[model samples]
Target: MITAENLTKRYGKTLAVDALSFSAPRGAITAFLGPNGAGKSTTMRMVMGLDRPSRGSALIDGKRVQDLPAVPRTVGAMLEMGNHQPRMSARAYLGWQAHSARLPRTRVSEVLELTGLASAARRQVGSFSLGMRQRLGIASALLGDPENLILDEPINGLDPQGVLWVRSLLTHLAAQGRTIFISSHLLAEVEAVADRIVVIGRGRLITECSMAELRERAGTRATIVSTPDAKKLVRVLREDGAQVESELSAQEVVRVFDRSASQVGEMAAEHSLRLHGLLQEKVTLEQAFMELTAGAVEFRDGGQEPSATAVPSAMSDGDPQ
Candidate 1:
């Protein structure tokens, strides 16, 4: 497991990471999410001891990562594993990692097979596709067969098939009791794999909670059902401090935004109204996460909202085409 407390980091005049604290539990996939320039990279670097924190501490297995003996044996990190030597073959490159880390030679081929790169093991690193490069990075990370995995944007350039492959692999690793702490801006994908979310915005912790808890805090949406009596119900609900909206169906779906479902249920009973349908909309982890980070994102400075147009493009494909 990884634990960070009041983790702070700074550069010259810029505070990169600000007082972040969270526990990445074992036997679970913990997702780290943030907007651009939210200090994700810096925090990861600090955890790996590639960078020092100006304040606070990040611990792995109950000890500071830097203090661990042979950290590579306990923590496997796949950060920006984009570096490559054009002339070096994939096999040779991975072999070098084994040599440097004193990892067993047999483990290299195992990771290659696990990442589906055994077929291209002889090819030069520079000739590998972007997807292949990501696999290679993952291979190196698993080389030590560490108990912890820290992957930053593991699906960044993956095609749909590659994305699914990565997801399954991470899930399997966590199932075997490894602590998987992955960072990604992809909400829907993270929702599937992550058991918990640690969100940061503008270099600070927004909230850390399980997927279900976050949605509960955000409140499930209620579809207001109405007819001509909808107007009366809407007014009554409004007077009761409930939020109501008119629907395109010529019906007003009463949404008790902050009200509990039980409260709404009780209110609906008291009205003695014959309702068509009273539905509570399910709030996905993505929506709840977006709401929490909405105002604090570093991407917006003038308070301008992001275009809804970008959401679709950012979504992972429904299936591999």
Candidate 2:
């Protein structure tokens, strides 16, 4: 398991990472999520010993990563892309990593194939596309057959197929009892793959829980109903203190909030109302994430507001006077 205890970092007067702590267990994909400038990269750097923490510790199996005797064998991290030697071929690069870690040369071939880079093994790193480069970087990380993996934006430029491959690969790795900790901006993909989620904002822990638990906290579901007795149903639902709204303009469809489909159905039966449709719209993980991090967004667009588009005073009715 990977554990972080009060890991903190500061740059000049700016506290990049606050006292943050979390644990990622083995046999599970733990997703780290945050908006831009939320200290995700800083925290990952601290964990990998690339950056020093102003205070606290990042422990891998009870020891600092820097103190690991066989660093690559214990942890494999792809913190960034485009960090490879431009002129070196993919095969040569993996061979270099293998040599540094004193691993058998055949291991390079294994990872190349495992990461679907066997065909491009002889291509120069500089000639590879962003997606191919991402694959090559992952191959380097797997070169050591480490028990833990830390990847940052691994699917940054991947196509649909590439993204699926990554999702499946992470799932397979975690199933093998390896610790998989990932940070990504792809919420839909994360929702589908992550077994646990840790969200941080402004360098502090915002919330951490299973995917199901986090959705439950969102609690903004609505019941969609299509009934012939729309007027009566709306009145009855409103009397029950449920917020009802039209689902579409000039349509019989209505959405009832703060209530479930079953509740609406039962109410309809109690009053002998004919129901054509009834369904509940559950909160999606993406919605929950947005709501949770809305206040914590560090950077926002500086564009003019909608009201700012109003006609200028000199161009208005009084201007010609």
Global lDDT scores for all candidate models? 0.79, 0.84
Best by TM-score: 2
lDDT score at residue 308, model 2, on the 0-100 scale: 26
TM-score of each candidate? 0.80, 0.89
Tens-digit lDDT string for candidate 1 (150-255): 9988988899999999889989999999999998878889988888899887678988988778776876666545444566666667889887676544654555
Clashing pairs in 2: none
Clashes in each model (backbone N, CA, C under 3 Å)? Answer: 2, 0
- Candidate 2 lands at a TM-score of 0.89
lDDT of 2 by residue, 1-321 (tens): 899999988766667778999999999999999876677888887899988999999988788998999988999999877689999999999998899889999999999999999998999999999999999889988888999999888888899999999999999999999999999888899988999999987778999898878877876578999877888888899998989997544558989988888899999999999998898898887888888888767545796342221211221110100
lDDT of 2: 0.84
What lDDT score is found at residue 47 in candidate 2? 90
